[model samples]
Target: MNVMAKAEKKISSAFIYFFGSFGGILFGYDIGVMTGALPFLQADWHLENAASLVGWITSAVMFGAIFGGALAGQLSDKFGRRKMILMSAIVFMVFSVLSGVSPDMGEASAYYLIIVRMLLGLAVGAASALVPAYMSEMAPAKARGRLSGLNQTMIVSGMLLSYVVDFLLKDLPGEWAWRLMLGLAAVPALILFLGVLRLPESPRFLLRKGDEAQARKVLSYIRKNPAEIDQELASIKETAKEERQANQKTSWSTLFSGKYRYLVIAGVGVAAFQQFQGANAIFYYIPLIVQKATGQAASSNLMWPIVQGVILVVGSLVYMWIADKFNRRTLLMVGGAVMGLSFILPVVINWMMPNMNPMTIVVFLCIYVAFYSFTWAPLTWVLVGEIFPLAIRGRASGLASSFNWIGSWLVGLIFPIMTASMPQEAVFAIFGIICILGVIFVKTCVPETRGHTLEEIEEQGTNHGRVKANNPEN
Candidate 1:
C-alpha cells in the first residue's frame, strides 16, 4: 500500500474501534447521569415516600435492560450486529432528551421520569450486549482482549463525562441542572450513530450468514496482507462449519446441559457477581452515600464522584495495557481480593473508631473503584465475548448481560432502603462479604482464556463437548 493509503487505513481502524465501542459511553453516561440527578430530582419534586421512589427511578432502567438484552440477542442474531447497534443509538438519543424534559404532572412526574429512564435502559442494555460481541468479532485474535477492553474504558470515560457535566450544572436552580445532566447523553448518542455509518458489519457475522465475499472485503479494511486475510477467514469458516455440524439443536437450555452448563455458570456468574459486589451503589448513588455519611447536603457531594470517576478511568487504562498479557482468572482473583479488602476495611475502621473521618471511608471507596475498574469491569465483558461458541454467542451473551442488569436492579432498588435502616458501615460490610464470595467464585469456577483465538476457544468447545472448558490451557 502507498503511504497515503496506509495512513487512511490506520485512521479507519482507529474509528472502527472507537465508534464500535462507543455504545459503552452511552451505557456509562446513563448510569452516571442518574447519580448526579437523583438528589436534585428529589428536592424539586418534593418526593414523599422518597426511598421507594428513589429505588424505582434508579432501578427502572435496569428492569428495561433485562428485556432489551434478551431481545437484542435474538435480533442481532437475525439482523446484522451493525443494524442493532444503530437502533440502540437512536433509542439512546431520543429517550435521554425525553428523560431530561419529563413533564411535571403533580405526583405523576415521578412516574414519567421512571418511564423515560426505562426507555433509556432498553438502549443501554442493547448496547451493552452488542458492542462487546461486535468488537470481539472484528478485532484480530492477538489484539481482541485490548479492543474489547476498550468498551469498559469507554464506559468509565462516559461515567467521568457525566460526573463533569453534573458538577458543572449542580448549581443551576430548580430542574434545569438535572435536565441538562440527563439530556446531554443525546450528544454522545448522535456521535455514535453518525460515525457507525462509515463502519462495516462484523466479518464473522457476515461469513456466518454465508457472505464470504463481503466478509473478506470487510476484513481487508483491517487485515493488510492477503495471507493474513486468508488465514483468519479460514479459521472463522471452520468454526462456523463445526458449530453448524455439531449442534443442530442448540437451544438456550444447552447452556445448562451437561457440557455447556459450567461455561454458563462461569460467564453468567461473574457477570452477575460484578453487580452483586455492589459497585453500582457507588457509581449510581455516591452523592447520597456521602451525604448520609458526613451529614452534608447532596449537592456538596459532587466532587467525590469526580474523584472516584478519575480513579475508575485510570484503572481501566491500566487494564487496557495489560489485559492481553495475563490470565483472566488471575487478575479477577487479585482484584477481587483488593476490592474485598477495600470494602471490609472501611467497615472495620468505622466500627473501631465510631466517629472516624468520613474521608477515610471515601479513600477506601476510591481504592475499591480503582480495583473494580480494571478487573470485573473489563474482564467480565471480555470473558462473555470470547467464551461462548459462535452458534450460541449472541444469546448466551445476552443472557449474561441480562443477569448483570438484574443484579444492578436489585442493588439499585435495595441500597437506598437498606441505607435508610442500617449504618453505612454495616451496609458496605454486606457488600464486602459478597465481594469475598466473588473472589472464591472466581478461583473455583472461572477458566483462563489468555492467548487463545476465538477459533481455538471454539475448537476446545468441540473437544470438550461444550463452548468453554475449565482446564484453561486446552
Candidate 2:
C-alpha cells in the first residue's frame, strides 16, 4: 500500500506538469496550422491577389494576443494562474470552431475569419504568458530551466503536429480541408480544459492570498521532501511580505519603476527580440517563400514545413538536455550570432554568385530554425518567468508576452508586403541586423539566473539597484 501510494503521487505530479504546460500546444497549433491552411484559404476565398488581406488574416491572432496577454496578466494576478488557463482553454475551444465554420462572403469571409481568429488569440496570448509563470513557480530552481522548457517543447511539438495534419489533410476537397484544420485545435483545448481542472493553484499565489495551509498542501505534492517544502514556503512568504510593503499596490506602471524597471527591460527586450528576429516569417510562410523562390507548386511546398518542424522538435529536445547546464546569456548570444549569419549568408552568396540556388535559401533557413529552437525560443520564457519579483510577476510577464506578440504581429503582417516590394535576401538581411542588436542587449541587460532560486534572483536585482544608486557613474 505504501509503495502504491508513492507511485500514485509521482503519477499525479507528472500529470500536473504535463497539463500545466499543455497550453503551449494550443498556442503553437494556431500559429502553425495556418501555414498549411492559408493557401487553401486563399483559393477558397478568392484572395490570391489580396496580399494585404492575407497579411491581416495571418496577423489577426497576434493583434488580438496583444490585448489578451495584457488582460490575462492582470486577471491571472487577481484570480490565479490556474483559473486563467482554464478560461483561456474555453476561449480557444469556442473560437477555433467559429473560425472553421466562417461563412464565405467574398472579402467579408476573410474579415470574418480574422475576427474569429483574433478572438482565439485571446487564449493563445493567455497560454503564452501563463504556462511559463506556472511552470516556473511549480519547479525547483535546480530543475526549473528544464521543466519550464517543457512549455517550448510542447509548443514546437504542437507546431509539428499541425504541419503533419496539414500534410495529411491537404488533399481534402476545397474549403473543407482548411476548415477541419482550424476546428481541430478545439480537441487540444478541450484536453487542456479538462486536465487543468485538477491542477493546484500556484503555491506562491496561495501564500499571497494568505492561505498558508493550502499553500503547504500544494507544495507537498510538488516538492518531495517535507523540509524543503517548509523552507520554500517560508522564503516565498518573506518575499511576498517585503514586496507588499514596498509597493503597496500593483499596476501596469509598476513594471517600469525602480528595480523592476531594469528587470522588465531585460525580460521584455528578450521577448520582443525572439519574434523580431524573423523566425515566424519563416514558420508562417515557408511554403509561400519556397514557391516564390523555386517556382514550385504551393501544394508541393507543404512538405518543407514538416522538414522545419522536425528540426525544431529535435532542437527542442536538445535544449531540454542543456537548459540547466549552460548560462542563459551564453546560449542567447551564441544562438543569435549563428542565426544572424544564417540570414546574412544567403544574401552574400547571392551577391557573389548572381544566381544562387534557391535550395540554398531553404538549407540556411533550416539552420536558423535549429539554433532558434534551442535558444531564444525557449529561453525567453524561462528568463521572463525567473527575472520578475513575485508581486508583479503576472503583470510583468503579460507585458513581456504582449510585446512578443506585437513583434510577431508585425513580422507576420509585413513579411508578405516587404517581400512583394523588395528582394527576399534584402528582407532577411534586415532581420540579421536585428539579431546582432539582440546579442548586445542580452550581454548588457540580462543577468545570469542559472541555478538561482526565485528569491535569490529577486535579491540580486535589488542589490544591483543599490550598487547603481551608490555609484551613479557605474
Candidate 3:
C-alpha cells in the first residue's frame, strides 16, 4: 500500500462513512426530535392527554418500526441498500411534514398522528436495519468497528441535534416551534436521499446479486489495493458459500437448521436485550423525567433535555476515537456500568437541588448523559452488526432490529406508566438494575468483535467459535 493509494482508500472510506452514517443521523434525529416536540403539541392540540398518552405518541414510531425491521432483511436482499434508504427517506419526508401539519385528531383522529409516526418509524426502522449493514459492508475490514460506529455517532448526533433545535425554539410561542422542529427533519432525509443517490450499492450485496464486476468496482473503491479487494471479496464469498450450505429455504425454522441457530440466537437476543437494557428509557423520557425531578413545567425545564443531548455527543466522539483499542465486550460492560451508576446520580441530587443552585443540578445531569453516551449509546449498534451470519444477517438482523424497536416500544410505553406508578427513585433504580443485569449478560454471552474483519465475523457464525473479548484473534 503506497502512501498515495493508502490516502485514496482513506478518502474512499470517508465517503462511505459519510453516506452510511447519514441514515444514522436521521435515526438519531427522529428519535430525539419528538421528545422535545411533544410537550408543546399536547398543549396546542388542546388535549388533556396524560403522560401515558404522550408516551404513546412518542413511541408510535417505534411500534411501526417493528414491521419495518421485520421486512428490511428481505428488502435489502431483494431491493438493495440504496433503494431501501431512498424509500425510507421518502416515507419520513412526507410523514414528518404531515405529522407537523395535522389539523384535528377528531377529523384526522389522534390515530392520524400515530399513523404518521408509525410511518416515520418505518423509515427509521429501515434505516436502523440496513444502514449498519451497508456501512459494515462498505468499510475496510481493519476499520470495521470504527466504521460501524458511524451509525451510533449518527444516533447521538441526532439526539444532540434534537436538543439543540429544541433549545433554539424554547423561546418560540405555542407549538409552532415544535412543528418547525419536526419539519426540520426533512432536511436530513433530503440530504440522505440525495447523498445516497451519489452513493454506490454495497459490494457484498452486489456480489450476492451476481454482479462480480460491479462488486469488484465497489470493492476497489473501499479497499486500498487490487489484492486487498480480492482478499475482501474472497472472505465474503467464503462466508456466503458457508451460509448457502447452512440452507436456503429462507424460514426462521431454517435458522434452526444446521448451525445457523447460533447466529439467529446471537443476533436476535442481543438486539432485543440491547433495547431491554433500559438505555432508551432515558433517551425518550429524559424531558419528562427532568420535569418530574425538579417539579418544573415543560417550558421552564427545556434546558434539562438540552444538557442530555450535549453529553451524548461528547461521549460518542470519545468512543469513536477509542473503539478499536479496547475489546468490544469490555466497552459494553463498561458502558452498562456507566449507565447503571448514572441512574443513581439524580437520586443523589434531587434532594439537594431545591437548596442548591441550578448549576449544581446541571452538573449532575451532565455526568449522567456523559456516561450513557460513552457506554451503551454506541455499543448497541456495534454489537447488532457483528452478531449474525451472512445467510440470516438480513432476516436475523431484521428480527433483532424489530425486537430492538419492540424493546424501545416497551421502554417508551412503560416508562411513562412506570413513572406514573412508581416513585422517580424507584424508576431510576429499576433502570440501574436493568443495566446491572446487562453487565452480567455481557460477561456471559456477548462476544468481542474488535480488530476483526467482516469476513472474520462471518467465519464465527459458521464455525461455532465464539470470540471472547480478551482473547487475541488467531
Candidate 4:
C-alpha cells in the first residue's frame, strides 16, 4: 500500500476506535448526571414530597431502560448495530433537553419530569446494551478485553464529569444549576450522533446477514494485517454458517436450551449481582450517605462524590492495563472478596464503636470503589457482551442488560427507604453478603472469556467443561 493510503487507513482506524467507544460516554454521563443533580432537585422541590420524588426521579430512567434494553437487543439483531446506536443518540439528545426544561416543582410537574426522564432512560438503556456489543464485535481478539473495558472507563469518567459539573455550578442561583447539569448531556449526544454517521456496521452483524463482501471491506479498515483480517473474517463466516445451519430463532425460550442455559445463567447472574452488590448505592447516594454520617447538610456535600469518582476512574484505568493479562474468573473472585470485605469491615467497625469517625466509612467506600471499579463494573459488560453465540448475542445481551437495569431500579428505589427505616450498617451488611455470594457464583458458574475470540468462547461454553453452543434441534 502507498504511504498516503496507509496514513488514511490509520486515521480511519483511529476514528473507529474513538467514536465507536464514544457511546459509552453518553451512557456514563446520564447515569452519573442525576447523582449530582438530585441534591439540587430536592432543595428546589423542597421534599414536601421528597421521599416519593427522590425514589421516582432516581429510578424513572432505570425503569425506562428495562424496556429499552430488551427492545434495542431485538431491534439491533433485525436492523443493525449502527442504526440502533445512531437512533439512541437522537433519543438521548431530545429527552435530555426535555428533562432539563421540565416545569417547576408541583404535583403535575413532578410527574412530567419522571415521564421525560424515563424517555431519557430509553436512550441510556439502549446505549448500555449496544455499546459493549458494538465494541466487542469491532475489536481485535488480543485487545478485546481492554477495548470492551473502555465502556466502563467511559462510565466512571462520565460520573466524574457530572460531579465536577455539579460542583462548578452548585453556586448558581435557583434550579438552573441542576437544569444545566442534566441538559448539557445533549452536547455529547449530538457528538455521538454525528460520529456514528461515518462508522461502519459491525462486521459480525454484516456476516450474519450474508453480506460477506461488505463485511470484508469493513474489516480491512480495522484490521491492517492481511493475514489477521482473513483469519477473523473466516472465523466470522464459519460462525455465521453454523448459526444458519443451526436454524436459531431469536426467541426468549431459546435461552433455556441445555447448551445456552448455563451461559444465560452465568451472564444474567453476574449482571444482576453486579447491581445487587450495591456499588450504585454509593454512586447514587454518596452525598446522602456522607451527610448522614458526617452530620453535614445534604445540599453542601457535593464535593465528596469527586472522591468516589476518582477512585472509580483510576481503578478502571488499572483494569484497562491488566484486563487481558489475567484470568477473568480469578480477577472476579479476588475483586468480589475484597469488595465484600470492604463492606463487612465498615459494618463491624460501626457496630463495635457507635461513635466511629465518619472517615472510617469513607475509607471502606473507597476500598470498595477500588475493587469494584476493576471487577464487576467492567467485567459484567465484558462477559455478557461476549458470552453468547452470534445467533443470540443481541437478544441474550439485551436480557442480561435488562436484568442489570432491573437491579439498578430496585437499588435506586428502595435504598432511601432502607436507610430511613434501618441502620446503615445493616444495609451495607446485606450488600456485603451479596458480594460474597458473587465470589462463589464466579468460581462455580461464570466462564473465562479472556484470550479467546467470542466464537471460540461460545463453542467451549466454560473453562470447567466443554459444553458446546446450543443446538436448536435438541
Candidate 5:
C-alpha cells in the first residue's frame, strides 16, 4: 500500500474499531451510573428500609436484558449485525431519556424507572452480544484477540466515564443528581448511533447473505492485503456452505445437538461464570457496601467507584496488551485464582482480626476488580465471539449474552439482600467459591482459541471428542 493509501486505511480501520465497540459505552454507563444514583434514588423514593425493592430497581436492566439479548441474537442473524446495532443505539438513546424523566409516583416511580431501564436494557444486552461478534468477524484471525478484546476496553472505559460523571454531579440536588446521571447515558448512545451509520457490515454476515461483492468491499477496508482479504473470504464461504448443508434449518435445537453442543456449553459457561464470580456485585454496590461496612453515608463514598473504575480501566489496558499473546484458558485460570484469593483473604482477615479497618475490605474489592478487569471480564467475550459456527454465531452469541445477563441479574438482585442478612465477608466468600469453580470449568470445558482462526476453531468443534486429544491444551 502507498503511504497516502496506508494512512487512509488506518483512519478507516480506527473509525471502525471505535464505532463498532462504542456501544460498550452505552452498556457500561447504564450499568455503572446506577452505582452512584441508587443511594439518592433510595432516599428520594423512601426505600431506605426496603432492600428487596432496592435490589429490584438495581437489577431490572439485567432482567430486561435476558429477553433483549435472546431476541437481538435472532434478529441480528436475519437483519445483519450493523443494522441491529444501529437499532440498539436508537433504543438506548430514547429509553435513557425516559428513565431520567420517570414520573414521580411515590414508590410507584421506582417501578416506572424500572420499566424504563428495562427498555434501555434491550440496547445494553444487544450491544454486549453484537460488539464481540461484529469485532471478531471484522478482524483478521491474527489480530482477532486484541480486536475482540477492545470491546472490554470500551466497556471499562465507559464505566470509568460514568464514575467520573457520577462524582461531578454528586453535589446536585438528590432528585436532579440521580436524574442527570441516568439521563447522561443518552449522549454516548447518540455517538454510537452516528458512528454505526459509517461502519461497514461484518464481512462474514455479508458473505452469509450471499453478497460476496460487498463482503469483499468490507474486507478491503478492514484487511489491507489483497491476498489476506481473498483468503478470509474463501474460508468464510467454505464454512458457511458446510453449515448450510449440515443443518439446513438452524435453531436452538442445533445449538444443543452434535458438534455445536460442546461449543455452546463452553461459550455459555464462560459467559455465565463471568458474572457469577460476583464482579457486578462489587461494581454495582461498592458505595453501598462501604456504607454498610463503615456506617458512613453511601453518597459520601461515591469516590470509591472512581477508584475502582480507575483500577478497572488500567487493568483493561493491560489485558489488551496480553490478549493476543497469552492462552485464553491460562489467563482465565490465573485471573480467577487471584480474584478468588482476593475475596477469600478478606474473609480470613476479618476472622483473624475482628476489628480490622473497614477500608481493608474496600482494598480487597479493588484487587478483585483489578484482576477481573484483565481476565474473565474480557476473555469471556473474546472466547464467545471466537468459538461458535458462522451460521449460528449470532444466535449462539446472543444465547451466551442472555446467560451472562441472567447471572448478572441474579447477583445484582441477591447481593444486597445477602449482605443485609449475612456478614458481607460471608457473602463474598460464596463468590470466592464460585470463582474457584470457574477455574475448573475453564480447565475441563473451555478450549484455548489464541491465534486460531474462527474456521479452525469450528473445525476443532466438529471433531469434538478429539479436541483435547488433538490439542492437549483443552
Candidate 6:
C-alpha cells in the first residue's frame, strides 16, 4: 500500500521476468556460438577424414539436439521445468569448458568434437523447451504471448553476443579464439544454473503433480496478492479438474481416438516445419555464406551475423508488441506469407549480383528476418505449449519437440550436402516451398488460443463428443 513497497514489488516482478528470461539467452547463445567455433574446429581437427566430414562435424550438434529435445519434454514433464533447466545448465558448463579446451584438430580425436557437440546440444535442447515452458506458466494471462516472446529476444541476444565475440576474436588464431568464444558461454550457463536454483517450481507443473501447496507457493509470487492468488487458483483448479478428468480416459490411442488426432498431427507438423522453412539455413550457415559474399576474411563474416542478430532480436521484440494486438492466427498467416516471399530474396540476390543494385536484396533479407522473428519464431512455441492437454502434454510436447529436433537435424545433416551438391537456388527454393506448406497447415488446422486458459485450450479438442479434459472416471 505504501509508495516504496509498491515500487519494491514492481521491481521484484521485473527481476523475476528478467531472470525467467535469462534461460532464453542461454538457448540463443548455444545456437549461434557454434558458427564462430566451427572453422577453427575444422582446421584443428581432421575433419577431412570423410568427403562429408564437414557435414558430420556441423550436424553433430544438431544430432545431439535431436535427442536433447526429446529428452526435455519427458524430463520437464516429470522433473519440473526449473530443475530440468538447472541440470541442462550443468551440461552447458561442462561442454563449454571441454569444447574450448578440445585438443587441436590434429591431436584431438574427431570423435571428441562429436561427443562434445552432442552433449552441448542436450543443454541447448533442454533450455529451449524449459524456457518456453517456464515463461508460459509464469506470465500474466494477457501477457503470455509477449512474455513467451522474450524467449525469442533472449535467443537472438545470445546469438548477438556470439557474433560480437566472433568479431572481436576474428583475428586471433581460430583454435585459440574459438575456444575462448565458446568457453565464455559457461558464464551464462552458471548464471542460469544458480538463478533458476533459487526460483520456484512451475505452478502448473506442481498442480499437475497434485502438489497444491507448492503450486500456491509459486502462484503467491507470480500473482498480484492473496486475492489475486485466490482468483488464479480457482481458475487453475477448474482447468486442472478438467485435466484430471481427462487423464481418467487418456491413453496411447487418445491421440487418434477422435478429433484430437488432427490436433496432434497439426501441432507437431507446424513445429517441425519451423525448421524446415530453412530458418536454420540462415542461422547455421550465415557465417560461411557471408564469408563468401563479401570476400571478407572468416572472422569478418561474423559482422553479417551481428546484422542478422539485430534483425532477429528487433523482429522478435515486435512480436511482444503485436502478439496481443492482432489475431494470433492472422499473425502466423501473414508471417508465413512474408517469410515465404522472403526466401526468394537470396535467390534474387544471387541472381542480380554483378549487375543490379544489391540494396534491394539486402532490404529483403532484413524484412525476411523481421517477418520470421515476429511471427513463427515465438508463436510456434506458444501454440505448441498451450494447445495440448495435461494428460497428453508430457507425451505431446515430448513427441512434438522430437519432431522439431528431427527437422532441425534433417536440415543440419542435409544442408551441407545440399550446399555442396546443389546450387544456392535449390536451397532457397526448398525453404520457400516449405514455408508455403506451413501457411496452408496453419490456415487449415491450428486453433486460435488467445484469451483461453490452459483448461480451455484442452477443451477445444474433444473426443467422441465428450470434452477430452472432462472424461468421466472409468
Tens digits of per-residue lDDT for model 4, 62-166: 989988888999999999989999999999999999988998757777789899988888888898889888989999878888988988998888889888888
Better of 4 and 6 by TM-score: 4
Task: Name the better of 3 and 4 by lDDT.
Answer: 4
Ranking by lDDT: 2, 5, 1, 4, 3, 6
Model 4 CA lDDT for position 40: 84
Instruction: Check candidate 2 and list the clashing pairs.
Output: none
| Residue 376 lDDT, candidate 4, scale 0-100 | 88
TM-score of 4: 0.94
Clashes in each model (backbone N, CA, C under 3 Å)? Answer: 0, 0, 1, 1, 0, 2
Residue-level lDDT tens digits of model 2 in 345-442:
99999999987898898889999999999999999999988888888899999999999999999999999999999988899999999999999998
lDDT string for model 1 (116-232, tens) is 888888999999899889988888877888999999999999999999999999999858998888899999999999988777889999998999987987888877789989999
List runs of model 4 lying over 4 Å from the truth. 1-11, 462-474
Q: What is the TM-score of each candidate against the true structure?
A: 0.95, 0.96, 0.91, 0.94, 0.96, 0.88
Which residue pairs in model 5 clash with each other? none
Q: Candidate 3's residue-wise lDDT over 254-310, tens digit each?
A: 666666665566667667766776767766766676677666776666676766777
* Full-model lDDT for every candidate: 0.86, 0.90, 0.75, 0.85, 0.88, 0.73
Q: Give stretches of model 1 more than 4 Å off.
A: 1-11, 465-474
At residue 153, what lDDT does model 3 achieve? 82
Instruction: Give the winner by lDDT: 1 or 5.
Output: 5
Q: Candidate 6 residues 371-392, lDDT tens each?
A: 8888888887777766676666
Best by lDDT: 2
lDDT for model 3 comes to: 0.75
TM-score of 6: 0.88
By lDDT, is 1 or 6 better?
1
